[model samples]
Target: MRGNHVIAEAAIRAGCRFYFGYPITPQNEIPEYMSERLSKIEGGVFIQAESEIASIHMVIGASMAGGRVMTSSSGPGISLKQEGISFLSALELPAVIVNMSRGGPGLGNIAPSQSDYFQATRGGGHGDYRTIVLAPNSCQEAGDLTYKSFDLADKYRIPVLILGDGMLGQMMEPVELPPEIPVKRLPPKEWTITGAKGRPSRFIRSLILDPFEEEEHNWKLMRKYEKISKEELLWETFSIEDAKMIVVAFGTAARIAKGAIKRVREEGLKVGLFRPISLWPFPTKILKEISRKVKHLFVFEMNMGQMVEDVKLAVDGGAEIHFYGRPGGIIPTPLEISRIISSYYYQKKLG
Candidate 1:
């Protein structure tokens, strides 16, 4: 199945009942799949919102009512949803957002690109906030991560993102769908504005007019983020022990780098790949430890050099840092990446 369809199906299996999204390229299949499947289920609702802004607000509303909700988009559409996302975070609402990212500062094109790394890692909206970001490098993980994202969102009562790209969304691959696993455990939504039927009324708003109250709210959010950083850091490493050079990449770029690392290793170069499965709360500590053992590190991405900054901060100049990338939807093939590494190695060797 296509990655978008797998995610949509996984959401259903994970007991997500409400979906609100605007149609956008490379991800329209998500909404299209949900539109057909959700309406047929009992008590399920799928709405094709008029705009990305409206769609995100609708997600916020459904989540406030204690519904498992989701919305998907690409680059520009994601920008439109940021304000609503910030609102969700401030209110500590649980929701899932998928970005089948395309190349862009504007509407660059409907091709895969990882330019939104900074936007997703740092808060895209206007505030000091963080969201749990998951990067799935394959169609299987696309489905698997989408299934797990709902749990993570509810566990933290914050937004969780499944960040993919156009290529992953459009491509098809076999994925083993898990049996319908009912969402049995979720933090009590005692704060939900279901009704004032028996007890005192509750409010679900991000506003706290008093200065001290607002500061308290921010501190509370930070505490949750800190706990997440400590307990939820996830990554995958390959061939790192005794390696002289390491390649760091994420999402589709990581998948490609795996192949590149294989090619380079076959040529008897000590190289490996370090893939961050979780982007935010990045695996910085692991990178720091690995950097101390390697002579050089390469950060590869589909964007110009977004993740390289994070790599630099993590490595902290423990090793020589290099970057390789192509923007505007140009994907770096395994052969191309291997060749680049070979060139750099030979140049340094001659010098």
Candidate 2:
């Protein structure tokens, strides 16, 4: 199945009963699959919202109604949903969002790109908040990550992002869907709005007018973020024990980098790969640990360079830092990456 369809199907198995999203390229398959399949479920609801804004708002509503809800889109459409994302953040709602990003500053090509790195890692909307951003490098991870995203969302009571590029969404590959994850595994969402029946009326709010109350709320959020950082930072490392250089990448770029690292190793270069599975609450500590053993670090990405900044901060001058990237939807090939690494190693020797 296509990766996009895998995400939709995986969401079904994860007990997501509501899907609200608008149509967008490279991700149309997700909503299409949902529209076709969700209705068959006993309580499933699928809505093809009129706009991205409407779709996100619909998700917020569904979430309040105590349903596992999700929405998907590309860069521009994601921008339209930022306000709602902020609302979800402010209310501390548990919902999942998938950004199958295409190249873009504004309505860019449908080709694969990771230009939304900042938007996903940083709070894209107004106010102080963060979303747990998960990046999947393969079709299998796309399904697995999408399935797990809902649990992370509920765990944190915050929006979680499955950050994939156009390549992952459009590509096809084999995947083994997990048996349905029983909802009993997660703690009950006692805060969700079911109704005002036989109990006190419930309120779902993001606005705190008082200065002291708002300040306290922000601190509470910060404390939760700290816990997530400590507990949820996830990444994968390859051949780091004897590596002289560490290549850092994520998502599709990481997939390509793995091949590049393998080829470079065959040429007798001591290089390894560090792929961050969680972008926000990034695997900084792991990078630091690996940096202690390597003399240099390189970051490869589909954007001009965004994750490189985080790599630098983690390395903290312990290693020489370099970046290679192709912006505007161009993917760097394995050979191209190997050649660059070769040149970099030789240049260091000469210096």
Model 2 C-alpha lDDT per residue in residues 33-64, reported as the tens digit of each score: 99989888777899999999999999999999
Task: Give the Cα-based TM-score of candidate 2 against the true structure.
Answer: 0.97
Residues 1-351 of candidate 1: C-alpha lDDT, one tens digit per residue: 999999999998988989999989989999999999998988889999999999999999999999899999998999999999899999899999999999998999998999999988987998779999999988899998999998899899999988999999999999999667665564566778788999999888888999899999999999999999989898999998867788899999998889988998888887888999999889999999988778688888999999899889988889898898999988889999999887776665621
The estimated TM-scores of all candidates read 0.97, 0.97
> Candidate 1 regions off by >4 Å?
183-188
- The models' CA-based lDDT, in order, is 0.90, 0.90
lDDT of 2 at 243: 83
Residue 271, candidate 2: alpha-carbon lDDT: 84
The Cα error of candidate 2 at residue 340, in Å, is 0.8
